[model samples]
Structures are given as structure tokens and as C-alpha cells.
Target chain A: MIQVIAFYLFATLTIAAGALTILARNPVHSVLWLIVAFFNAAGLMVLAGAEFIAMLLVIVYVGAVAVLFLFVVMMLDIDFAELRAGFVKNFPLGLLLAIVLVCELVLGIGAERAGGIQLGTPDGTAATAAGASNIEAIGALLYSKYLFLFEAAGIILLVAMIGAIVLTHRQRGGVRGQNISRQVARRPEDATVNMQPEVGKGVQL
Target chain B: MTEFFQTIGMTYEWAWFVATICGILLIALPLMLAVAMIIYVDRKIWAAMALRRGPNVVGPFGLLQSFADGLKVFLQETIIPSAANKGLFLIAPIITFTVALLAWAVIPFNSGAILADINVGLLYVLAISSLGVYGTVIAGWASNSKYPFFSAMRASAQMISYEVSIGFILICVVLWAGSFNMGEIVEAQKSHVWIINGFVANPLLFPMWVMFLISGMAETQRAPFDLTEAESELVAGYQTEYSSMSFALYWLGEYANVLLMCALNATLFFGGYLPPLDIPVLYLVPGWLWLFAKIFFFFFVFSWVKATVPRYRYDQLMRLGWKVFLPVSLGFVVVVSGYLMYTGHFA
Candidate 1:
């Protein structure tokens, strides 16, 4: 009963935060709302006992991604008045998209129900009784059954990394980039000069 | 309803709730006080190492100096920058301070003195500690100043880099112990004779411990890795514009994080609260005392390092973290995992 209440509380906060992220006029306020949404989502993940995922949400999404968003928004020259002008123009299209998205979600739920899916029901009570914790069960499945899928996901991420590099590979002159090989190969004498001033004003030493 | 109430009354669940609440409060209050004292101790240690007298006039051995300074900060007016993001600027310190305190909930001071002895205790600690970067990042961004913003960016990058190495090293420890529960890790250590005693036992484990220590120091933003707060460069770094109690919260939170890191190091490597000897008479000394001793020892070591070593340059720090620590820790994890798998110890 307590778990149910806690789950509802987190879900409500997440939805509220998501709405506020869009509704807030100020960009910084929107980022703050987005952070709140991430936190509540992490809370929901915790309630589901996916501690790893919950941690990743808080540590990576809230800690890194949202902070990056805040940095970008703070640094950019964003005029709220100008941004608001487009909202009136885009309102009809936005409403249409929202309705279509909601309809698709409802249809997804209906299809699952039609397939005789029993959400949150155990396949077999004896499976849980077989001396494996949730983490262990998930680990077993991930490594044994879905190992190829996991490796494929990693490969896709690697491809995305290369693509990002290729897209943004620019040569800006003023930025001093590291040349490790040259640095390692150069001798100290080549980079530094031992200077002795000739004694023009005094005596030569 | 009467029967239900009676059954609820008869059960000890309320006692558990009350006990948990009291435990949490106790952890919070003392931890804050301890953090304050740690600042005084750190200053005194630094002064002593430099052959100078520290704050001695405020209280006995300058004990109340932190409190006096804290009061001064409390009375000072908070200055919010005119161009800053008002809401985020206010919320940043609170987020940092609260997250720092929240991590203490799962830390086992003694055998069973933790507020909540959750099964995923170590993972929870890692998760919560990693969230501290948000506070630093937000403070920098909200200030709308160049110094704080740059410092925050440096801090975010540095912290995320070291955290990966730290996590990999901790995975080696967890693989050896075969459990994420901290209590079980300590218990596992108790069953084995000290590995350092024999040459035949795993010699590689010590390097993993060293990796954890280094990564932990970096994570806490202590000296050598304290590029975030390098005074000469960034002018107090992310907290430059903060004043009054706002600044004090950052100060308190930083020290609290250092203490947390120290406690975690003790728990992971130093056999936690367990004393060195197994003598029966020594068993009477409660486990919490041993834990306190170990934690203070590490805290002293941190201060010593801060006073002794010069800060690392940004490039040097980054190189050490990624090129040196990451690969070393990753290799250590693979070796340890392979050993455990072959030995069937976890099975």
C-alpha cells in the first residue's frame, strides 16, 4: 500500500514537472523543471527496484545532461519575446501532434490488452522461488539470451560517436590542441634556451 | 477496525519507524557537526605542517572557530547578482548541500548503525555522490559569470572522468566480495587473512586499493585535483559569487563530501569498523569506535596531502585520470573478475 502511494506521488510529480518544463516562459525555469522531471523519474525507477537504472537516471541525466542543457541555455543569447512569437504560429501543429501521440499510446495499450497480456504478473511464481534475485535474473538474461543485442547496441553507440566526430570536426587556429607525439619526442634543450647576457654594461663572464 | 488497530499497536513496526527516524536524525546532526570540526582540524593541521599557529582564540584549541565563522556568514547579507538566473541561483546551493547529506543515510558507521541498511548500499552511495556535480554545475550556470561557468565546466568534466575509474575499481572490489551490500563486504574481509601477510595471495589487489584512493580523492575535489577551486585561476571557482550562508553551505557540503569519501575508503579497504586483532577482550570496544578511528585517520591523511602537494595542472590531471587510472582500473577489473570466475569462489 505504501509503495503504491509513493509510486503515484512520483508519477504525479513527474507529469507536473514535464508540463512545467514546456509551460515555463523562462529558459532557465524550463531547465529547472526538466531537472525536477528527471528526479521524479529516478524516484519512480527506484520504486520499481531497478536501482541501477535509477542511479543512472540521477547520476547521468540529472548530473550531466540537464546540467549541460543549463550551460547551453545560459550561454546562448535567447530572447524570450522572440521565442514566444513562434508559439502562437505553431500552436495548431503542436496540438495536432499531441493528440496523435496520445491516440497512439492508447492504441498501444489496447493492443497489449487484446493480446491477453497480464501486466506485472509473474510468468511462474516458482521462477522467483528458484533462488535468484532480481539483479541476478536480469544479469542472467542479459548475458545469456540478449548478449548479441547488447553487443549490437554498443556497436551502434560507437557508430554514433564516429558520426558526431565527423560532423563537428573543425580546425580552429587559436585553440591550442595537444600534440602528444611531438611533445614526447622533443628534447628539453629544443624547447628551452639557457641565456647568458654578455656583460656590455659590466664585465664579460 | 479495532482489531486491526490492536494488531498494529501490538506489532513493533512503529518502533522500527521511530528507530529509523532517530537513526537518520542522529546521522545528520552529528555528521554536520563533525564536518564543521573537520574544517577546524584541517586548518590546524595545515598550519601546524607549515610551522605556524592556527585559529586559537575563538574557543578551546580554537574549537569554536568554525561556529564563529559560520555565525558571521549567517549574519552577512546574501548578494544575488543582478543578471543571474534568480531561481536557479537560489536552488543550486540547496541542491548541493542536500545531496551531500542524503548520501550519509546508507553509510554504516559501525556494524549496524546505518539509517537504512539497504541491500544496494554501495550502489546507492555511488549514485548519490555522483549527483553532486549538478550542484556545482548549476551554481556556475546560474551565476551568469564567466569564471564560475568555466570552473563548473571543468569540474563536471573532471568529476565524470574520475567517477568512471572509481566505479571500475569498486567493481573489482564488489566482484571479490560477490555482493553490493557493504556489511557483507566487510564480513568477507573478516573471513580472509590479510592478503598482504602472504606473497602467494593476490598481489594485484593492493594496486586496486590505491586506484580507489586516488580516484576518491579526485572525486572529492581535494588538492592536486582541486582545479575547480584553484584560487589563482578561477577566483573561488563555482562559488565565487555566492555569499553569506549560501557560501557556507558550499563550504559545509565540500567538507562533508570529503568525510563521506574518507568513510567509504575506510569501509572498502580498511576492513570498515573491524579492529586489527581478533582478541576477545578487544571485542568489547564497539565497532563504531573502530570505524570512527579509521575515518579520522583517512581525514587526517587528506589534510596532509592537501598541505604537502601542489595542485596539478588541468591537462596533467586529465591525463592522469584517463590515460593512467582508467586503463589500470579497467585491467584490474578484468583480472579480478576472471580470477573470481575461475576460482568458483562466488559460486
Candidate 2:
């Protein structure tokens, strides 16, 4: 009963924060609300016994991506007035999308309920014998049964990384990148020249 | 009504409540005390190495220095920068300290003494420790300062890079142990002659142990791998804008993480809480004592290194992690896995 209550509380907080993230007028406030939403989502994941996913959500999303979002938002000169103008213009479409999303989520939940879908729970003997904790089970499946899928996912990520690099590759004349070969080969004579000049003779070599 | 009350009394689950409370307290109290002692020991060790008397005035050899410092921090006002993200800035330290403490839940002090003896104990530790980067990142992002932001970016990149090699090394350990259970891993080691005793068939275990120790040192951001808090370069790094108790939390979190890494290193390789002995009679010395001895030895090594080695350059650190450690660990994993498979030693 307490677990149910805690789950409901976290679920409510997640929904509220997620809603506020989109609905807030201020971008900074929206980002803050998004972070809260992410945290509550992580809490929900934990309650569902998906600890690895929960941790990944917090560690990867909150730690890196959300932080990057926060940094960019904080540093950029964002004109709220200009940003808000689009919201006013697209309110109908936005509302339509929101309604559709809500309906889809409700439908999904209803479908699951109707199907009597249950998450697997291991018996104590099996758990002990197999050492099949949530993480262990997931790891076993990921490495063995779904190894190809896992590798494919990794490959896709690698492709995305390469794509991102290619997209962002810029050759600017003003900026200099380190040239290791040149640095290694350069001699002291090339770097410096000792010139001796006679005292009180400015023009003398 | 009297029968009802008796029935209720009979059904009461006081043990469950008591156990939960004890578990929480077990994690909390030692963590708090350890943090305090870590601070004192760090200063004393550094001071001694630098040829100075370290904190001599507080108590006997300044044993009470950490307590005094804690009190002072608690008394001091927390300064909030005007342009800072107030919520994240305020919550970052708590996140850091809590995450650091939570990783201890799976760490076994001795056989069957862990708060949670989950089968994925090693994975849980890895996951929890990885989450610690969030606190640093949040602190940097929220501070609205350039230095903190740069420090956070550098720290996140460094941590993520090192974590890959660290994970690889952990995989090697796990492969050898053939179980993720930390206790089982230690027990497995106990069944064999000490790797250092020259009677062992495994020559590769020592190299893996060294790799794990080095990776762990990097993961904890200790010298000479402490680019995250390179004072001359980053000016206190992610906690640059923090003050008083907030600053104290970051400090505590860092040391706690270092200790956790040391404990993990002991558990994974150096026979955890198992003493180095082949004599069956010497097993009477309680595993907890052995664990403590091993942990402190690693802690001493950490301090010794910090005192002796110069910090690596940022690029050099990155080069070592990505170019050297990552490839080596990856190759080691492949070789170990193949050997284990061929020998029919691992299932």
C-alpha cells in the first residue's frame, strides 16, 4: 500500500513537472522543470525495479545532456519575447499534439491493463541459483541473446557520432590545431637564434 | 478487544522496521565518520610529506581538527551567487554526497555484512559511482561561472573516458571470478594460493590487478590523474563558487569516492577482506579486519602518490586514458576471456 502511494506520488510529480516544462513561459524555468521531470522519471524507473535504466537516465541524461542544455541556455542570449511569439502562433497545433500524445499514452496504459501484462518476478530459488538480479539478467540477455542487437545499437551510435563530427567539422584559418609531427621534428636552431650585438652600437650586426 | 490486540501484537513486524533503520544507520554513520577522518588524514599526510606539523593544536596530534572544521563550515553562511541557478546550485552537493554514500550499500565489510547483498553488487557500485558525475556537472552548470562550466565539461569528459577503461578492467575481474557477487569473488581468491606466492598458475592476474588499481585511481580523480581539481589551471574546478558547508560536501564526496575506489580495488583483486595467508588456522582473524587493513593500505598508497607525483597535463591525461589504457584494457579483456574459455575454467 505504501509502495503504491509512493509510486502515485512520484508519477504525479513527474507528469506535473513534465507539463510545466513545456507550459512554462520562461525557458530557464522550463529547463528546471524538465530536470525535475527527469528526476521523477528516474524515481519511477527505480520503483519499477529497472535500476540500471534509472541510473542511466540520471547519469547520462541529467549528468551530461541536461547539463549541456542548462549550460547552453544559461550562456546564450535568448530573447524570450521572440521565442514566445512562435508559441502564440502555434498554440492550436501544439494543443492538438498534446491531446494526441495524452490520448496515445492513455490508450497504451489501457491496452496494457486489458492484456494483464505483468513484469517478470523471479522466484527466490531461481534468483539465488542464477544470480539473476535485475542488472545481471539484463546483462546476460544483452550480451548473449541480444548481442547482435546490442552491437547494432552501438554501430548506429558510432555512425551518429561520425555524422556529428562530419557535420561540425570546420576549417577556420584563425584557429590553430596542434601539429605533433612538426613539433617533434623542429630543431632548437629553428626555434631560436642567438645574436650578439656590440654595446652602444644600435645599427651594428 | 484484548484478543484482537494480542493478535495484532503477534503479527507486528518490528524486525523488518528495525533492520531497515539499522541498515540506513549502518550506511550513514560510518560514511559521516569516514568523511571526517579522511579529511584529517589527508591534511596530516600532506603536511607530513611537505615537512610541516599538520593540525597539531585541536586535539592530540590534531585528531579533532576535522570536527572543528565541520563545525566552522556549519556555522559559516552559505553564499549564493546572484546569477546562479539557485535550485541546482543548492541541491548539487546533496546529490554528490548522497550518491557517494549510496555506493557503500553494496560494499561488504565482511562476509554477509553488506547492507544489500544483491547479486549485481559490482554493477550497482559501478552505476552509483558513475552517477557522481551528475553532481559535479550540475554544480558547474548552476554556478553560472565560466571556470566552473569549463571544469565541469573537462571533468565529465575525463570521467567518461576513464570509466570505459575502468569498466573493461572490472569486466576482466568479473570474468575471472565468474560471478558478480563481491563476496564470492573474494572467496574464490581465498581458495587459491596468493598470486604473489609464486605457486599460482595465473601470471596475468597481477597485471590485471595493476590495471584495475590504475583505472580506479583515475576514476577517483586522484594524483597524478586529478585534472578535475587542478587548482592552478581550473581554480578549484567544479566547486569553485561553492562556500562553507556546500564546499565541505564536495570535499567529503571526493574523499568518500576515493575510499570507495580503494575498497573496491581490495575487493576485486587483493583478496578483498581475505588476509594473505595459506594457513587454515589464521582464518580466525575476522574478514572485516582484513578488509579494513587492505582498504587502509590502498588509502595510504593514494596519499603517498598524491604527495609524490606531479599532476598530468590535461591533454596528456586524455591521451593516456584513450590511447593507452583503453586499448590495453580492451586487449586484456579479450585475452583473459579467450584463456578462460579455452581452459574450461569459466562458464
Candidate 3:
């Protein structure tokens, strides 16, 4: 009964926050609402007994992704009037996309209600133990059955990161950046000269 | 707590509700008092290290200084700038304080004595501590000022930068312990060897302990890494615009965070709530006392570092975090994992 109450509360808030994420005028507020939605969805995942995944969701989305969103959004100097000017112009396309998305979701759910495609056949070799925690189950599967796929996914991410860096990175020829190690390694004698000269005579270079 | 409540004549749900409330008070009230005492201790340490007499006015040896400051701050008006986002400005400090306290829920005070004995306790701590940056970031934006905004930028960037190395360092510990549970991490350190009490493993070469300590200092925005609030430059960083209890909340929250880092250092690298040595005779003293002693020792180290080390330049700080700490910690992660697997530690 308590779980039911908690589930409903999470569900209500998730829906409310999702709605507000779109309806909010301020971009910052919208991002915050989206974060709230993510948090509530994580709570819902927790209610569904996917505690590890729920934490990952909160950790990845709310902690990193939404923070980036907030960082970018706060720095933006968006003119609401100018932004609104494009709303009507893009309304038809947006509406069409929304409708198509809704249709896809509906059809997906309907197909699942009908003879749904089973993602995989039950393999006794990789079966999760009854009492194992979600993390344990995930680790078991991820480290064994899906290990290659996981490695491939990791490689793909690595490639993408490298590609992004390669694509954007540029060298400005004359810009001086601090070489901290060089500074630390410098000895006083190397950087300066202590010389004695006759009185009233300047030290030779 | 629920059982205790039931013995006092209450239904199960009511008992549970009462127990939770009581638990919150038990942690929070004491934490507040600790923060007050810790402030005095920090000042004294900082002063002593600087070869100066610290607070010697209020209560014996200025022990009540924090309380006096708190009362004064409490009496002052919560002045909101007309240009500032009032709601967010007010909510920011509350978020900071609450998030600061929330991470303590998973911290094992003694064996099985945590408020929440969740399996992913360390991950929860990471996630909550990450959320702490938001308070400062939001405060900076909400304040509608440039200095505060710049401070906020520096703070968030510095925080996120250090968190990467901190994450990898924690992964090394987690890999060493073979568990995410804080209690298990402590127990894993109970090997008969005194040197192996920490997850450091191979003390001379394995530098994860020092890395974790440095990262913890950076994560807490302490001196040397305290570029965010460098007074000469940013004029108190994200805190410049804040006043009254709002400002006081930030102060409390920042110290609370500093204390939390100290606790983490104790829990992760030192024997948390466990005695320094594994001698059975030493177990006579309570676990919580040991935890407190370790916490105080680490706090003194924090203050000592603050006194000794000069603040790093902003770019130098970034270079240390990204260029230096990240690679070293990441390399150590791979090394530790490889060594563990080779030794069949998992087996």
C-alpha cells in the first residue's frame, strides 16, 4: 500500500513536471522542470525495483546532462519576443512531428498488446539469480553474455569522443598558454643571473 | 527506531513516521552543533598555524563564536537584490544545505549504523555531491551580477573538473573492495596487515590515497584549489551577493561540505569508524569515537593545508585537475584493476 502511494505520487509529479518542462516560459525553468521530470522518472524506476538503473538515471541525467543544460541555458540571452516570432512559423512542422511521434508510440504499444516480438529467448546460461540485486544481475549479464557488445559500445563512444575532439580542436599559433611543469622545473639560476660588478657600474648582461 | 517507537505505544505506520522524524532530528541537530564547533576548531587551527591567537573572546576560548555569528546572521534581514531572481536566490542556499546533509544518509557512522544502508551508498553520495554544484550555479545566475556569475562559472567548472578524477579514484577503491557498499568497503580493509587498512594496496607505488586526498581537497574547494572564491579576484565568488541567513546557510553548507570531504577521506582511505591498527585490544573503544577521531584528524589536515598551501592560479588549477590528476588517477585505475585480476582477487 505504501509502495502504491509512492508510485502514484511519483507518477503524478513526473507527468506534471513533463508538462511544465514544455509550458514554462523561462528556459532555465524549463530545464529545471525537465530535471524534475527525470528525477520523478528515476523514482518511478526505483518503485519498479530497478534501483541501480534508477540511480544511473539520476546520476547521469540529473547530475551531468541537466547540469549542462542549465549551464548553457543560463548563459543564453534569448529574446522571448524573437523566439515567439518563430513559433507560429514552425507550428505546423512541430505539430506534424508530434503527431508522428504519438502514432509511433501508439503503434508500438498496440503491437506489444498484440503478438509482441520477444527481444530474446530465455537462456539458462545467463539467467539472473532470484535473490541477486539489480546491480549484480546487470553485472553478471554485462560482463559475460553482452561483454563484446558492451566493449563495442564503449569503443563506439571512444571513437565518437575522438571524432568530436578532432573535428573541433584547432591551434592558434601565437597564443601563450601556461606550461605549469616547465615553471615548476625552472631553477632560479637558470631564469636569473647573480653577478657582481664594480661600485657604480651596472652588471654585464 | 520503529521498534523503540512501538514500545512507547504507537501503530506501525505512525511509529515508522515518528522514527524517521526522530532519526532526522538526531542527525541534523547534532550536525548543526558540530558545524558550530567545527567552525571554532577551523578558526583556531587556521590561527594557530599562522602563529596568531584565534578567537579568544566569546565563551571560553571563543568556543561560542560560531553560535554568536549564527545569531547575528539570523537577526539580519535577508536582503534580496531588486534585480535578482528572488525565489531562486532564496531557494539556492536551502538546496545547498539540504544536499550537503543528504549525502550523510549513506555514510556508515558505525557498523550497520547508517541511516540508509543501501547497496549503492557510495554512488548515492557521488550523485548528491554532484548536485551540490547546482546551488552555487543557480545562485550565480539568479543574482544577476557579473562577479557572482563568474564565480559561479569557476566554481562549477572546478567542481566538475575535480569530480572526474575523484570518480576514477573512487572506482579504484571500489574495484579494490569489490563492493559499492560503504560498510563492506570498511570491512574489506580489515585484512590482518596494518598497512593494507586502506584501499591503497601496495602503499609505496600505489598513489591512489594521495590522489584521493588531493581530489577531495579540490572537490571541497579548499585552499590551493579555492580559485572560485579567491577574495583578491572574485571578491567572495558566488557568496558576494548573499547576505544574512542566506549567506549564513552558504557558510554552513560550505563547511558542511568540507567536513563531508574530510569524512570521505577517513571512510575511503583511512579506517572509517575502525581503529588505525587492526589490534583486537583496540576494539574496546566504540567505533563511532574512532570515526570522530579520524574525522577530526582529517579536518585538522584540511585546515593545515588551507594554512600552508597558497591558492593555485585558475589556469594552473585547471591544469592540475585535468592535465595532471585525471591521467594519473585513470592510469592507476587500469593498473589496480589489472593487478587485482592477475592476482585472482575476484576469485
Candidate 4:
């Protein structure tokens, strides 16, 4: 009974927040709503007994990604009228995309209801082992069964990160950069001089 | 606890609900009191380091200083800036204070005495800590002010930068413990290095502990890493525009986060709740007391650093997080994991 209540609560909030993400006028509010959507989805994951995935969802999406989104959106000097102007011009494309998405959702649900494939249930071998926790079960499957795919995914992310860094990084000839090691390594001897001079006599360079 | 409630004639679900509520109160109420006292303790420690008396007048040795401040804030007007985003401005401080308290759920206060003994306990901590950035970010943006906005931007970037290294550092600990469960991680530390009761005693892990300590400080936005609230430039940073109870919330929440970081340092590196030496006679002292001692020790360290070390410049702070800590921590992760594999520890 509690599970039913929690599922509905999470599901309702998720949909509401997702809707608000698009409907909100302010871009910052939109991002905040998107975070709310992510959070509720994570709650749903937790209710499904995939606590590890749920926590990862919160950590990666709501924690890191949405924060960047918020950061960018907050700094944007937005023209509300200009934004709304584009909405009318882009309506047909948006409507077409929405229709395609709706069709895909309907077809996917229809296929699931028609028993197109025998996806395993919760009580099957896919369920966590009798004594093992969620993380251990996932780890066993991920490391043993899907290790190559996981490593490939990690490599892909690394490549993307490096590509971004390389594309954005720049060197300017005139820019002075602090070498922290050199700064730390400097002693009174290397960067300084002690001299005694008579009156009206300047120290030599 | 639920079972005890069940014996009181409640249904299992009701018993569980009641037990959970009781558990939350048990942790949160004391946590509030502890935060209050910890503020005073932090000030005293900082004061002693500076060779000055701190908060001596409010109560005996200024014990009631935090409470007096709390009452003062409670009675003061909550001034909302005319230009500020009203709803979000109000919500930000609450978010800060609540998120600070939220991570304590997974913290094992003693053996068999955790609020939420979930499997992914450490992940939960990481997740909650990550949400902490939102408070500052939201407060910064919502205030629609220059200084607070800049502070918020610094905070978001600083937190995200440090979190990357922090995540890798935690992976090393998780690898060593072989479990994400906080209780199991604590248990794994017992007799970790011969008679030593901590992972810190291991030569391999000692560096990780140091990095984790520094990252933890940065993550909490304590002195030396507190670029977000650097008063010289950004005038209290994100809290510049805040006033009254809203301001007080940030103050309390900041100290609470410091305490939480202290707790994490104790739990992850120092043997959490275990006696420093694994002697039977030491077990006579309660586990919670030991945890408290470790927490206070770490808190003192935090206070000492705050009082002594000068603040890091913004670029230097970023340099430390990215250039220095990031690569080292990431390399340590690989080294630690390889060592574990080579030693057949996993096998």
C-alpha cells in the first residue's frame, strides 16, 4: 500500500516538474524545475529497489549536470520577448517532434502490452541475490557480464572530455602564468639579495 | 526499534514509521544542539590560536553565545531585497540548512545505531553533499545582486571542481573497504594495520587521507578554501544580501557542514567510533563517545587551519583543485586499485 502511494507521488511530481521545466518563463526556473524532475525520477528509482542507480542519478544529474545548466542559464542576459518570438516560428517543428515522441511512446507501450519480448520480472534471476545487497549484485553483473561495454563507455566519456578540453584551451603569448612549483621552490637565496651600501649609494642590480 | 514499537501493539508499517521518526529526532535534535555548541567551540579554538578570548560574555566561557545569537536572529526582521526572486530567496537558506542535516542519516553514530542503514550509504552522503552547492547557487542568482551573484558563480565552480577530486578520493576508500555501507566501512577499519584501528595507518592510504582532508575542507568551504564568502572582495559572498534568520541559517548551516566534514574525516580516515588502538579495555568507553572525540579533534584541526592559514586566492584555489589534487587523486585511485588486484585482495 505504501509502495503504491509512493510510486504515484513520485510519478506525479516527476511529470509536474518536467512540464514546469518547459513551461516556466525564466530559464533559471526552468533548470530548477528540471532538477525537481530529476530528483523525483531518482525517488522512483529508489522505490524500484535500485538505490545505487538512484543515488548515481542524484549525484550526476541533479548534483553536477543541472548545476552547470543553472550556472549558464543564470548568467544569460535573456530577452523574454525575443525568446517567445522564436516559439511561434518554431511551433511546427516542435509540434512535429512532439507527435513523433508521442507515437514512439505509444508504440513502445503497445509492444510491451502485446508481450513482444519476455523481459524478466523482479523475482527472476535478475533480482539481487538472497544475501547480497543492491550494489554488490550490480557490481558482479557490471564487472563480469558487461565489463567491456562499461570500459568502452568510460573510454568514450574520456575521449569526449579530452576533446572538449583541447578545443577550448588557448595559449596567449603575453599572458603571464604563475608557476606554483617555481613559486614554492623559491628560497630567500634565489629570488632575493642581501646588500650593505654606504649613504647615497644604490645597490647594484 | 521497529520491533520494539511492534511490541507496543502497532502494525508493522506504523511501527516502522514511528521508529523512523524517533530515529530522525534522535539524530537531528542532538545535531542541532551539537551545531550550537560546536560554533562556540570553533570560536574558542580559533580565538585560542589567535591569542585572544572569544565569546566570553554571553554565558559561562560563552557557552550560550550561539543560543543568544540564535534568539537574536529569530527576533530580527527578515529583510527581502526588492529585486530578489522572492520564493527562491526564501527557499535557499532552508535548502542550505536542511541539506547540511540530511547527510547525517547515513552516518553510523555507533554500531547498530544508524538512522538509515542503506546499502549505498556513502553514495547517499556524496549525493547529499553535492546538493549543498544549490543553496549558494540559488541564493546568489536569486538575490539579483552583484557580489552575491559572483560569489554564487565561484561557489558552483569551486564546489564542482573539488567534487571531482573528492569523488575519486572516496573511490579509493570504497575500494579499500570493499563496501559502500558506512557501517561495513567502519568495521573494516578495525585492526586494519596490525594493531592500528584506521585505514590512515596504511602507508598507501595515508596520502589519500591527507588529500581527502584537504578536499573535505574545500568541499565545506572552510577557511583557506572559502572563496565563496571571501569578505575582502565579495563581502560575505553569497550571504552578503541575506539578513536576519535567513543569514542565521547560512551561519548555522556552514558550521554544520564543517562538523559533517569533520565527521566524514573521522569516519573515513580515522577509525570511526573505534578506539585508536584495538585494545579490549578501550571498548569500555562508548562508541559514540569515541566518534565524538575524533570529531572534536578534526574540528579543532579545522579551527586551527581557519585561524592560522591565509585564504587561497581564487585562481590558486582552482589550481589546487584541478592541477594539483585532481591528477594526484585520480592517479592514487588507479594505484590503490592495482595494488588491491596485485595482492589478490579482491580474489
Top candidate by TM-score? 4
- My TM-score estimates for the predictions, one after another, are 0.87, 0.82, 0.94, 0.97
What is the iRMS for every candidate structure? 2.5, 3.5, 1.4, 0.7
* lDDT at position A176, candidate 2: 69
User: Candidate 4 residues B1-347, lDDT tens each?
Assistant: 99999999999988998999999999889989999999999888888888899999997888999999999989999899999999999999999999999999988889989999998999999999999999999999999899999999999999999999999989999999999999999999999999889999999899989998898899999998999999999998999989999999999899889999989988988889899999999999999999999999999999888999999999999989999999999999999999999999898
After the best TM-score superposition of candidate 3, give how far the Cα of residue A174 lies from its true spot, in angstroms.
2.0
Model 1, residue pairs in steric clash:
none
List of chain B TM-scores, one per candidate = 0.93, 0.93, 0.96, 0.99
Best by lDDT: 4
Using DockQ as the measure, the top candidate is 4
- Which prediction has more favorable DockQ, 1 or 2? 1
Error of 4 at B207 (Å): 0.6
Give one clash count per candidate, in the order shown.
0, 0, 0, 0
Candidate 4 docks at the CAPRI level of high
Residue B337 CA displacement from its true place in model 4, Å: 0.7
Model 2's alpha-carbon lDDT is 0.79
Candidates ranked by DockQ: 4, 3, 1, 2
lDDT of 3 by residue, A38-143 (tens): 9899888876667787888887888888888898999999999988989999999999999999999999878866748543234412223687867888999999
